[model samples]
Target: MVIDTATTSGDTALKQKVSSLMSTLKSDLCDLVRIRSTAGGATTEAANKVVSLLKEAGVSDATTVKIGSGRAPLVHGTVTGRTGKPTVLLYAHYDVQPAGSWNETEAFTPTEVNGRLRGRGAADDKSGIMMHVGALRAFDKNPPVNLEILIEGEEESGTGSLEEYLAKPENKDRFKADAYVVADTGGIAVGRPALTATLRGIAQADVTVRTLDAPVHSGMYGGPAPDAFMALTRILATLHDDKGDVAVEGLLSKPWTGADHPDETTYRQNAGVRCGVPLIGTGSVAQRLYFKPSINVTGLDGAPPPVHKSLNALQSEATARVSIRLVPGQKPADAVAALRRHIDQHRPWFLPVEVTYAGGGEGFEARTGSTTFAKAQAALQEAYGQAPTTLGQGGSIPLVNLLQARKPDAPVLLWGCEEPAARIHAPGESVHLDELERMTLAQALFLKALSQQ
Candidate 1:
């Protein structure tokens, strides 16, 4: 629920300043989006662009730090204010996921259609990088709060160098702040503001089923011979019950108590659920999505394609990869172990399967009702004209868990312009200019608010 508030005096000035930077922000965002900063892509160029933009925004001591070999460089910069004022660490990433197939729209070409800018990294964090720039620009490069900016280059790939940098004794004060603002998250919708208070972690494993050492002729042994593909499918099918809730035992499920969840119809439309196909899981969308653990079948091996199918043969081996999003309070190791146990207990026909676990990250749950959170709520309300809703993102940022551990005293704030329609990390990704404008103003206001006390 949102509490309405009248426009404040400071917001009046903030709006004017943000309005003035719209054109420049748009042009700069387009240029930054054009840089290919995907994992294993041209990160050097992207880091250079970020440093240049930070310099132009009046940041001092802008530099890049490349940790271990193969790790992308970290763009570090800072802006100092009055000595007594509070300091804030602004975090964002210059890197993005690889641009998948662009059916019609070109990836990395920032095209403006209607009021949205479309391109790779336009929303799931080039918009974030520009948000920091736009906010700093609004303050005329001398923000009311002491500003420290860290734009990472390997966030999409999870290099963990930023955490390493913070751990060093020399870099201890570099990120010491009263509050940390990460702009890689999203609002509930285009114009609605939100603060992500929780993030789900991930656990993965590869499961293989081998029914026979070699392929057998279905024409000769069709009834007696068991198909590995069919056996794997049956095992996977048992992961979900008739209602689609995860049937795995011992996984966490704490119902979401934040903003009203998207209704079934809205979710169906967004997910492109086929007509008459019931949605997976039960309860409110927020409950099922944000609170409960979710398992996704990400990949399959040894599955013959339609054109390559041979009807007379039964496959000897089949493998599948499963990824589970762990809800807050569930440890990754425990989740992985539970998943293996569930698989072993539920396999059809007592079929033996191989389960290999992969590395996983822990989920994070932020403490609410703190002074910093209140200040953020006020800032978001001043900019968006309504109380910000507390939210839990379905996705995980491993770095956030690390940051929370490193800076336990400073509250981490997550709010960005990316909405559901942004389609971030997917083809035709885009961000609405109006949302970006409001988020910039909110960040500026947040810094000012933090400086007050």
Candidate 2:
């Protein structure tokens, strides 16, 4: 997309200019997609290339700050502009989910076809980060407002340290801003604009049931001995009632009023639900996924034998991993506590069960009446020539909430380069050129309008 070299022009003219610069956008974006930034010990040589690009983009203050051992570096870039205007901090993660085997399509090779760019980082967020750079470049890499960019590297593993980096004294003070823009969300579908205003928090625990010392032969003690796997499965069965509602108490439940979710056909096409089974539950998709708690069985251990033909029967221990997605108003700690108590209270046949807290994060919901929200919504609708769908995302970005706490006076806007059909977190992750161009226009117009305000 082309940024009009001239300033203070009409929105339509600027959009035309951005549309004309498509070649440059793809060329510049390719440099970002070639990197591997998964959360781990070693720094990716490709991520260093991204660091250089930010430097070239006139981010005068740029550095890679390390988290604890085993966490990848967080790339930070800051540029201070006119003092009277507001500051905007942009959040994105550079690290990608691991790319599994590919016979013909290599994980590192970024490809473009049918107006779509495909690769590991194209959608799940290197290109989104590139949108940040594109926005900065469209505005000459130095807009009317002060800005800070934080690109993280530990998102895939779910061991977030960007929050910790933001909490550090030196970085925390410098990272303060009036508004934070987290460009990590996706459009509802191709050409369907959206803004994610709420995110469900997460809590995880391991629940174990130990009914016997070791494997007991079924013939010797079958009917009388309590089976650990059966007990564990029974306890798990109680987590969700027949209607698929999470049965735990005090975890919080509420009706969702944000936006109408797409029908099952859309969900199946996006998720590739090949088995043709309808999604569970009769409630609104938004209510079931975002505003209410969801319990999932992540992993399990014991009772079942390996793939062999052994005759040993079930006995000893059973462990199951449980994950809860809490609504905006629920705290992770409170949910975890309630989950533990509920599990303990519902044990089968007086069997001993243990619940251990694993991990968690608090949910977030934002008011849509802010000036920033108006500016974004107007720009999105104007650019795409369609009404923007306001909705809630099902996942969490831990640092965005912290940014809200640190900068309470400003509104945080969410937009991005991804779309639901991009197949994010899976092979063939991609970005449509049309959506990227529209987003560039939206961001350009939003920034200009914001600067006006």
Candidate 3:
């Protein structure tokens, strides 16, 4: 769809303005990345920094507000536009994941290599914050639509307080909007614009298996005694079939009908799959990733490192943290129950097994076919020179569901700068400069289009 000549000219000018502010955007993003705002870490500092940036970008009322006890601060602000104009809430997270041993550079130390900025939060979400800031700055702080900025601090930590805050009757007016721009998700690939239409929910549990009262000597009891570690592994092995499909019953799944995923070669490269390692599961890649339930043993706490602390003893107890990703139709609680039932039915050797609920959140499926979504697609197409496509993320963003619940009428637009190569939540995380620029421009154009509507 071709934008009118006048709109195209304005978009050209806005694009130039966004280009001019790229340096500032990069600087602000790098500074934000330097904060170690992991789930329970320096999120307050990151939120405050975002508040300061928002104010500098013309959100004069921007300030950090506490949501709940033990939860990170939330940054809130608004830019009032012309009377009768539709409101748009800009959303992104300031918190980041902990830096594991995978980063090429210090997770807190932002580095610019080639055309990418490398840091922990640089891609996952810190860039999302900067994208909103850049788009507002492009409009010189006076956007065409009424703008509300909600930069979250605990999104990576399960968004505990925001849920309660939004549920209050008095807070409804604060978030009333015609559209919600959730900049926490990303495109399908660099320079390929895409909107995330669905997100998988998460259900996790800590399963403990106790085989004996205490550790026993391997040589003395190896023949007759059951090992807790072995029993735990056996229980986990039942989660998948021979083809790697989830073996758990009662979990909901359906075929994906969105844009096709990247070819196997590209997907393997993007996912950093080891050479010769086959991609597991059946059906289309998109279906496996976005429409089906998958289980993973995220952490184990029974066996010592064999290479460093090998012991000639059998463990008495073993515990594993299992994470299950759920599709849109499934409830988190129901999924957890199904998982428990599966483990109970598959326990080996009658070992004593206990399951403890970890945390979980429901998935989201955006309401498409709205005027706001259409404008967003047009804006992306204009910015990238290609039509935008729809995609679904396997990861969970709890706040998306909460915000949707609060404002069911508002169309939620999920797009960002973290493409496949950005490596979000993994080592060597980075965001392409071009992707950031295009997204910022697209956001600015989208808001302008909304104002005209």
Candidate 4:
């Protein structure tokens, strides 16, 4: 990654301006993080807060658009630029994942420690919102290119509200742009700059197993009666072979040709892998994560807590939510079908089994050969003192595919401040201050370069 030193005087001034706004950025980010805007929770306050911030940043038309009667609101706004300059659509999500039991810090309370902001959504997406806000403020909300801001409130939920809204013919023209910047992804490390060039899609299913009509005493049926919980465990065990790779047939995968993943020690530290537990699967970390199908039992029910709530009985039924991450070129429907078939074939004791489809979306591969991509690389190089590397994200953003399909020619850039250490969707989520500042400057520089083109 070679560093470029061809920054113009204006670029230098912009960098200085962004630096001066760091305190404000941190303050604003903390304010946003203070709001408990978890998906399906009350998010109207968060939406209004974003609209107010955008308006204060010089986007006077910023407001929240209701998606449906009960769905979360979408924050939309635009800043007009000089005629002949291209339009750039900026995207980020304000909704956050639920804070589970693992958080070291309070999930909604914003805390700053060692130059990082700690809270739920601080790095996953709320920081993404701040990235756009800080950049627009650096330019006094008048960017070099025409700007269309569409901040979603249901990205973490995977409800497809934004996708359905954008699909409408009446609303298509408002989102059309020469370039799109999705600020929901991030680099590989704290100082390393990366643009997510590909993203794995998601497919999910609910698997239920039934053996008997009702529970029976374990003392009487322990040896012969089929236990639905035990049966469910056996069925789930078949999802992965001995090597821990997905055993489902007809799913697609390919060799990873992008930037290499972190080494084992760093990867373990980032993932918080328990010590002495060997990593499952074959091939390199990037290959396993970016270019292959993986399955996880995300939820399970019908079994009581083993410690105090356990019953010594043969359970009649059990159910689990299975989540599958599909590689590029794999259809969500096909993956779900394959998963259902695999579940049916693996049922033990000729038990009754059911598999039902859940929601999912297709993966995305960016058009990285475009001039906009080059500008993004140069901008990141200028911001981080090294040329950016392209990487693939293991997560899915269904909206990215919709945008790409809507405007096939426009390049969609995915970059953000959330590095591996951020622990997004987990406890102790945080965003490094320096990474936030650099990402903001990079976005500002990319917009300036696009205006020049």
Candidate 5:
């Protein structure tokens, strides 16, 4: 998988320039990860820092755009390229998921260990921020293709602020590009680059069940008491059949036709499944995970935390947060409606069931046959020294759908510096240094290839 950059002297030179900036890359990555940019935290600070870094990295027109005073502003800037060259918009996010606790170091404090950087936003997106910066710096600020930076400040929260910003008529021309590179997705494995071809959408609800007016003593009404928790559990049990496939009516499932899905053993290890524990669901792990609807009880309220002890009475009411991930071509609203209908049909013991519809976003399916996609394939292969794989992400990237809707002609490529071992959104989140560097090279090569067209 030697990169076919021999015919392009500038592209070959860009690779060397990126390699020379390894130390600077790590420094910038660690600095970006150290900012506490969680959804509820000071994301404005992170956004401002990204703007400043972009300016320092050669983007002379870097600036922050804020819709409101309290909202985290988006960072937008550009590096002018040769006349008549195509413009490439690089997209990433600064906001990170909530970090519960840390293992080796504090969530906000980036720690480097054995070629990995560990922190809250280190891999999920802070590394994404640096990956773009490294790529732009490789071209000395002005890439072969005109470069546009649109680092969103609130993507994880799914507020769609950036989408709204881009929708405005005045802002449309400012951010318009021939191609979009979303650096928020990860490779299949470290050093194994992958272009995400699809993303699954999510729908959620807080379901409650009430069976009694008040708590009853277990000793007096142990068998006869209509416990709300028991009834709620029964209703949830109907979500999955004996084969572990989702049993909800009207939901959709399809076979995955791209990329190499993770093997059962790798999936188990990544999920930390206990020894001898059978994997749930039917079909291949990728099919069940990426191409089928899945239900999960994310949170249960009014339950004892196991550290506390109170087991004498039957509770009168119970609530659980149910999250459902919908595959591509499945509408989020339809899935939500189907789930509500399923709950209605499976009310245990005719108990009162209440379902509240939370918000959800639409999934994305990429077109792999486009010209920009071909350039991306070549760029990724050149950067990784191996052919890249095409895969679909099970997580939702709502903005991808918005981008497609607004600019259907522009192809979107999803690639980034994280891998499964990064543990994004969980404890011990980290980024592989090599993946970050290679992604930087890939973006540089991608821009050069697109420019030649």
Candidate 6:
């Protein structure tokens, strides 16, 4: 961690400037993979061609960083390093995730299977924004840190203008930084090399159940009716207790001392786990999927208990959709008010229960003593040669907890470029090519070791 960036004063011209920027990154990754930019608001014409590819990678101040309404247009850009040095922000996002079944042709075409490179935000982040524009055009774009390529088009629909484009107090002293380069993650296998400190924060709740008012009469009041689908299956069987964990009441748990997963028959073929199902409650799947706090009842809309709706007799309702995964200093609206006081004091029989509220994001444990996480773990052990294993991504980058709740000691780092089997939004999502050239040399030797830290 020592840099002083004069773009590292030429030395064999930085390996011929990363080989002429990998031939202009295969034509700028096929022109941002022909843009579909997925998820609603299509992301302003691929965020205006990534703000004209960050003003043609020179970034003498790029643009498009709008707020709220625009959906996905946080392309801001900047340059300036030499004089004094120290600076490196680089975050990534160009709005994606949402491109299924293309019957004819157009998930934004640009295929190229064998050499690996598809569409829908190719590898969950335009291949980490074309490896930060091929390591800033192999230094020709003058990268050695002191850059701030903060892209975003709503990180797949959550980082919407990421906390209003990093709450503008003049971008907190021009996004002051010493580290941060999420070239998207992956590498527990292939060449194996990962370094994702931690990220877990989220809590959502949605439970509904009512008895009497409309459709009823299962065999003329099937045994003294009043059945909102067996009272939402006995309130989802009292929210799991007898060993299945999660009994709600004040949600939060601990004991997942950082990264150590994959062991349940490789998690039944990486989460397919069917035969004699039992990969649920145990220890370490990154400790119940990234450091504790998980209770998913997903969804359960009413009426239709396996066919038999005897017209209108009265009413009977039932609905469930609870989602929780908060961890970093838990407070997703107080774990959604303790799952609404454990489903209003578990009175499923007396009926009348309605607790609704969904939307939460605040979980990240990233603070393993910094210095840019130890030079991003020696640039992921020199770009995937080995040693680099640290995990905890129970998925929740709600704008990195809104930029760590407005720079709570800013130094956020999360990996990207698709991994959990790159099925990102599903269907042959793809992204491998030597783990995208070892994540473009671990984001170009972590921006030349944070521009000479």
Structural similarity to truth (TM-score) of each candidate: 0.90, 0.88, 0.95, 0.96, 0.92, 0.35
Question: Residues 382-437, candidate 4, lDDT per residue (tens digit)?
Answer: 99998778999898988888887667899999999989989999889999999999
Write the residue-wise lDDT of candidate 6 on 1-453 in tens digits: 441222334433544555556656756766776676766745788888888887777886788866766656678788875676766678777777666574214555657677666666677778788778777766667776577778877766554456654666766655656555566656555566676767677766678877777675567777677778677777778877876767787877778875576556765775566888776565667787777777787667874644464454434776777788877778788998988888778876666787777777778777757776777766666555566777777777766655555556767777755666665665556666557656665666676766665
TM-score of 4: 0.96
Pairs of colliding residues, candidate 4 = none
Ranking by TM-score: 4, 3, 5, 1, 2, 6
lDDT of 6 at 406: 51
Those runs of model 1 whose alpha carbons end farther than 4 Å from true positions after fitting are 1-10, 158-174, 210-227, 306-316
In order, candidate lDDTs are 0.84, 0.77, 0.87, 0.88, 0.83, 0.69
Per-residue C-alpha lDDT of model 5 across residues 1-453, encoded as one tens digit per residue? 233434367767877899999899899888888788887787888988898899988888899888643388888888774699987788999999887765424888888999899999999898889989998788776677777888988888767667666567776655667788899988888988899998888888889988678888878987887888888889899999998989999988878877657889888998899999999888888888788888999889755336466677887889998889988788777888898899999898777799987767777889888878988888888888888888888888877776776578989888898789999999989999989889999888888788778
Which 10-residue window in model 5 sums to the lowest lDDT? 1-10
State, as a TM-score between 0 and 1, how close model 6 is to the true structure.
0.35
Candidate 2: lDDT over CA atoms?
0.77
lDDT for 303 in candidate 3 is 68
Clashing pairs in 2: 1-18, 1-21, 2-17, 2-18, 2-21
Q: After superposition, how far is residue 171 of candidate 3 from its true place, in Å?
A: 4.7
**lDDT, ranked from best to worst:** 4, 3, 1, 5, 2, 6
Better of 5 and 6 by lDDT: 5
Task: Estimate, for each residue in 1-453, the C-alpha lDDT of model 3 and write its tens digit.
Answer: 433323567888998999999999999989998999987788888888999999998999999888767468889999885799998899998988889886534878998998999999898898899989999899998888888889888877775688778867888766877889999888888889998899999988999998878998999998699988998989989999999999999889988898777667878988889998999999888889999999998889986457777888988999999999999978888998998898889889877799998878888899877878888988898889888888899898877877776678889989999899899888888999899999999999999998888
Give me the runs in candidate 4 sitting further than 4 Å from their true place: 1-5, 102-105, 168-174
Give residue 350's lDDT in candidate 5 (0 to 100).
78
lDDT of 3: 0.87
Clashes of 2: 5
